[model samples]
Target: MDGYTTALVCAAAAAGAALVRSGKRYIDNSAVELLAAPDGVRAMIEAHCPSLVAPARARLVPPPYLPTGMLQTIYGAMVALRRDSESDIEYDRQLRTMEDGGTVSLDWFPARPSGPECAQPIAIVMSGLGGSAYEYHIRCLAKHLATKSRAGMRVAVLNYRGSGRTPLTSSTMYNGYDTSDIYDTVGYLAQSFPRAPLVCVGFSMGANLLARYLGETGDKSRIAACVTVSCPFSGETAGRAINAPGLLFDKFFQPALTGTIKRIVKRNQDIIQSGAITYDIDAIMRAKRVCDVDNALTARAYGFKDCWEYYAACSSTDFIERIRCPFLAINALDDPIALPEGLPMDQIAKNPRAAIALVAHGGHIGFFSGLSARMWHLQPVLEFLDAVLADKAE
Candidate 1:
């Protein structure tokens, strides 16, 4: 072919690639079912989180390289490596001594000044398993709320005991079943900023904890609104899915998560040796899957007979019915870790205050989209939060 013909062919190929990369992924059956939510709540969510509706274009399109749900879910696990335009958020760390002599760390992001009375709304972020305030998604949410949110929201991340490098002052460690640390942290924030309306956003395992806390506390929960992203609501199903034989689970998630368990145990070895943790630490270290770690550590740590009992206890379906606060659960149908089959849709349906945002394609906590496929969940979360606050103010 002549030089001109060759150039035209190349340009055509480039255009095709661009179209493929930037193509919109429409959500099927995208109307967000509000369950038993009131008309007002439904209207509020529809107005704010329009992306939840069906036939609407899903903001998250898997990168060309990572097209499948499993691949995207795996990508989410390594989000810390993708340093996008959102800058690393710096936080002022505060170490608080819990009632049990255990210590937890709170990382606070500076909010645009609300006033001398600290009247701004507060957003407390709870990171995923073995994650911290430094996690990429956490920073994105904090940055959005602190810099961009109309509420001028002050953001604080709760680094549970032994996670986020927080020192284990006592033999006690955090588990999916326990809500004490979060409960205490919420109380502390409430006291510190009495005038500030408190809101919460929890990711993955942290989401489960937040859900359980809301249910256990019922109407007494101080949180004005809450959002849970990629929560493994049904612990049994979620555990099985994560431990199942698969490219992502076996090669990546299992080992990575098992390693996190070992590291947590090793980091707090001095405290584990003191008592309370009755499991075989050496065996737990050799464990190949997350369930094994849960069986040996999490179940035993929380006084359960075994992992099965622990899983049953950790199930959020039992808790969702009791949650009286305005709550939203964002779940991806394609989530590999937090299996979509495990979503507490029935449980959520029972509570008028609760709703679930079911999207067709977001994998686990991965809702990455746009030309670059950067994190996309932040926008919907912000919208829901802003709506809740606005509704409350009225």
Candidate 2:
């Protein structure tokens, strides 16, 4: 073919591919129609993600604490998802004595091997900031989802470096987490379960990591697909949004991180007494805030200049268009953590390789829609993952 003809064909293909990558579901108010909650839940979520309270038949769900059929079972897990204790705290444990810089032990759910003929895909779950494998009802969801299908999936929860056993090799972590860790873990799993399909899901902080992985890695991904729930694509906007005064976010999260870090620091009094580092443990915790935490910690602990440099280097916004795999990112405008400014839903919708699922609610890592405030943890999350993976075979 002539150069002109060849160029035209290439343009057409490119346009078509872009179209395929566009928004997963037609957004706007219609998206929130699926949430099942009281008027208060809608209002709460809307306060964070306004688009989360759309007019879906989803409201038909029964209220929490009430006894219903299968829905009750799911609600039980939701309650569990919301509950927390000292163990769930991220950075508060006493750490001066612990050798691993107060890092928690690594935790993971067991996975059954996925032999051939099984369409059921295994799901790898990534938890949010200061969150453990137990924090967000993930355990409940994993257990519950396993019961539904024939060849049940293996649900593996990713505890960030310091959150669990994988303590920080560095002092503090960054906003855009180390995607390489997740990629490596998933790679290890794929090799172990060659016949089984693998799917990945992340929430809030975890979601950002997943999105980064999607955008950064070229089209040749080993995992089947990914779901990013409540992730902020643009670091600056999200940082600004969460940092905004009067939202109660800093108040809600800072103490959690501070408290955790203090506990760890106190535990390792010997390390402090010996002057392993210049600053005291409490001083380190005091330096952390929603916006400043990543920088404060990284600089003091891991030795980065500031958070901006770290965010710029790690943020996934630059990698969006290069992703070749099929993935779905769920967002809610009302979510306090992930705002919709430079989120670029239009760009996502235009890309055929993506399924940009947007909602108006499910605050940060708190997407309990269609779930009750009872039970142990979030149950339906596994179902959502299951449904998404099952679709892959069809």
Candidate 3:
């Protein structure tokens, strides 16, 4: 079968994998509907904007699949190679560049045997939650964007404050719920690399911060173009999904954050004694259902009165309408993290400069489907970003 035919089959087979049992205790709350195709024929119509495909309202014009098992394996391997490249990231600390008295660090991307100039617009990507700049997934994306063939581009994997190899210096913590640090980091880059156009990409919670930053600052931001991949645009709807039963997401995520909070405090006895926080991190997660780990962590780390206040002020959905930057948002309906209903269609539509792309399935950044783990640039992303970069400011 041709490549096109192979993809259709994978999409159909994968559709069944996306459905979650409605009454099951685990992910009992999954809002998935497996769309059965008729013999899986190849066809295409119009597609929604990239941003719409990420959150709740994301939809793919054609379901994602492969024609045969042979194709699937081939596609899977190519992406897995890059995805696993996270193991190669090197962590380094900057002694003189300390922030808030904490050691600053970055997860360096491994350049090809030959070096490339960092002159082109570097992709500064932000990770979510207890996530590190060395996260396998984000590294996979960086590898794609910073290829030698595409050598003009470079990638900087940002760990915010506490999440990476560097120690958290200030009593304050980095949260997806806020964007001040992103602002500071971008400002530093703008000053350092004024000639290069900086493109910002954020995933999941990270995307929310990107959106919020653009909305709040409007055109004041120095970024030339932006991309938000699989961001939860609506707090209320995402909260419901986080609390969804079958996914076991809340169970898996909450405890990890809870433990990180403990570790963060345990490492600094003086901070705990200072009553710098309202409640213990574990206690907060136990008592209240947090929208995201950021919702809880930000409030505690920053001495906010409550998690609700922090989430509202920090999350981008509140300020999405205010964003005036040229931004692209990619969302998926099958995303376990960002539910379909969580997309802010009205707010996005209101922004004339924004575009949203909604795909049928890509398993929470697992858009792997091709010949034996080999991939085809994941479609629109490879093409769209290329087009975006093509129009350089002459």
Q: How many residue pairs clash in each candidate?
A: 4, 53, 56
Compare candidates 1 and 3 on lDDT and give the better one: 1
Quality of model 1 by C-alpha lDDT = 0.79
Cα distance off (Å), candidate 3, residue 157 = 1.0
- Measured against the true structure, the TM-scores of the candidates, in listed sequence, are 0.88, 0.65, 0.69
Each prediction's whole-model lDDT (CA)? 0.79, 0.53, 0.55
Top model by lDDT, which number? 1
Task: Between candidates 2 and 3, name the one with more favorable lDDT.
Answer: 3
Q: Which candidate, 1 or 3, would have the higher TM-score against the true structure?
A: 1
Query: Compared with the true structure, what per-residue lDDT tens digits does model 3 show for residues 136-246?
Result: 566666666666314256667777655665566666655656566777777867776676677778877788888888887886878766777778777545555655554
Tens digits of lDDT, candidate 1, 307-354:
888888888888898998789888878787788678877887767788
